[model samples]
Target: MSHTSTAQKKLLSRVRRIKGQASALETSLEGEPKCISVLQQIAAIKGAVNGLMREVLEDHLRAHLGAPDISQTQRDEEIENVILILKSYLK
Candidate 1:
């Protein structure tokens, strides 16, 4: 398959699974499961999102973010952008 197709498959698979987890979380609320179960579901969603981000960031870095043999200035720019991304999510 083409790269875009492969990437879409991966993303779609992850999102579908995440949707199921969210549904389970909602059902769990009806039964009044422990707080931990809710936390786990939330964590699973976060992890799914993080995995997607990792895949996208890797692709971006390989395709456009930086050269394999980037100059110092280019490397600095890429590093700064990555740091900014992390900071944005951490906030």
Candidate 2:
């Protein structure tokens, strides 16, 4: 099985925290629902997830695009992938 590295492990921990925040939002949904508080928590979770995505993207770029010439084809591919991710999820 593939294993996560140290940086990935840290990112997973942060994502788990976000999952807890999302669970809290769901539980709150069943209650009278503190609207503003629940919304704030949701926003926080979204931001955390975004940060995790950014970290993964940066790691991919570093691992795949390393070279004296950052203008290489591999670097271009990395940038294109990042753009695709942003377009698909961040928008």
Candidate 3:
């Protein structure tokens, strides 16, 4: 199995929590929630997403880049892919 498969359950749990947070934010907006409450929910969702991204990115680095068995060319390709993704994500 792949490395991500090993952590699939944890990842899915995080995604579910994010979905719930989004739903809560939607509900709050539908009602008359305070501005602070909306901001807090948005921040919570963003933090959760960033945490999830960090976890997957770390796993990818370990599995794809840190593996000694892979060729240098393969490692270089993976590094370039990671850099491209990070640039797009940051933007």
Question: For each candidate, what TM-score against the reference?
Answer: 0.66, 0.77, 0.96
TM-score of candidate 1 to 2 decimals: 0.66
Q: For every candidate structure, what is the RMSD over all alpha carbons to the true structure, in angstroms?
A: 3.7, 3.2, 1.0
State the weakest 10-residue window (summed lDDT) of model 3: 1-10
Candidate whose lDDT is highest: 3
Ranking by TM-score: 3, 2, 1
Residue 68 shift from truth in candidate 2, angstroms? 4.5
Q: What is the lDDT of residue 3 in candidate 2?
A: 21
Best by TM-score: 3
Question: What is the C-alpha local distance difference test score of each model?
Answer: 0.79, 0.77, 0.96
The sequence of per-residue lDDT tens digits that candidate 2 reaches over residues 1-91 is 1223757679779888988998888888888877898889889988898888877777766666655666677688877877897899856
Model 3 segments more than 4 A misplaced: none
CA deviation > 4 Å runs, candidate 2: 1-4, 68-71
Clashes in model 3: which pairs? Answer: none
